[model samples]
Target: MNVAAVLSCALLLAIWGLPWSDWLGHFPAHMIRHMGLVAVVAPLIVLGFPRLADPLALSPLAGAVLEFLVVWGFHLPVLHEAAMASSVVFIIEQALFLIVGLVVWAGCLRTGGLAGAGGLLLTSMHMTLLGALLTLSPRVIYALDHAGALQEQQLGGMLMLAIGTPIYLIAGLWLVARSLEDTKDEMA
Candidate 1:
């Protein structure tokens, strides 16, 4: 692997080692770490080891749906609470985040056209919607243990918007432009 790729892998491990709850409170920290995994780390890994993605045969649409389900399912009140309550559950949750992230990124990177763009765009939309809900909610949606203060919950949502939304949206748009260029090139 290239130095950059090795560094990114190390960074992923380092992020998990951080005491996110102590640094940014529970909810915001979790949100930031989650975003970092799926948005930053996952893409870096895909870019680093493109061949590693070959084993995954998921379509862009299916990859998006899988990612969406994993994210939302883990964020559900019951599951969220369990994760917060137990180290095992928390580890499982985090592992899944990384795994699904790799899958989605691999699929998108492999299929850099309308299919990739659409999947990424769809992910961006759902991420935005989820973030908005968390930010705008009057009452805390998740358990108090993980959600922390209401303000903290809102901040977490804001973090998601700040991190996940732009990354996915920009990636999608870039893929669309790439697709157009490829088509133009083929016609020439």
Candidate 2:
């Protein structure tokens, strides 16, 4: 589909093949199951369709609630730990991510003329922050004992966020500006 979706899928494939897969083997069966759910399916959905902004058009309060749940829900320590410990939890977490991502993407899309650029940028910010939290936890929240691959996963997560954030912001601003200019010209 689009470049974003393509890249996400590629990344997911790479993660699946990495050394961490071995550690995942150690996790309880339920956790492994959930990991597959999130790791395999969530990205496909996000990258599969371009997000439309209108879905994000809830009242301010509702929007805030949605954002809160999306960003903080899975990251909660207990939830995170459970997900890492069991496959079922992991699947649930990924499902949450997919749902939240969809909502966020829709919000971006509804922004109208600047949908492309702005939506991408906001999504990037959301993703980067989420990744950072996942990667930067001081203690091993997920794979309690697997330090080696966990460390690597953390680093990779951080790198993705650090690199992706600016790119999204810049692209979003450019699209918004371009849309504004178009509007101005129309008025002129």
Query: Model 1: per-residue lDDT, tens digit, 1-188?
Result: 78658966887877788788888888998898889988888888888776775666377888889989999998898998899899999999988988888888888878879999998899899889989999999988877754348989999999999999999999999999999999999999
**lDDT tens digits, residue span 67-162, model 2:** 456546665667767866788976676666545544544444344355555456555656577667657766565545645646655654555455
**In model 1, which regions exceed 4 Å deviation?**
145-148
Model 1, TM vs. native: 0.94
Clashing pairs in 1: none
**Strongest candidate by lDDT:** 1
The lowest-lDDT stretch of 10 consecutive residues in candidate 1 is 140-149
lDDT of 2 at 131: 69
Best by TM-score: 1
TM-scores, all candidates, are 0.94, 0.57
Worst 10 residues of 2 by lDDT: 26-35
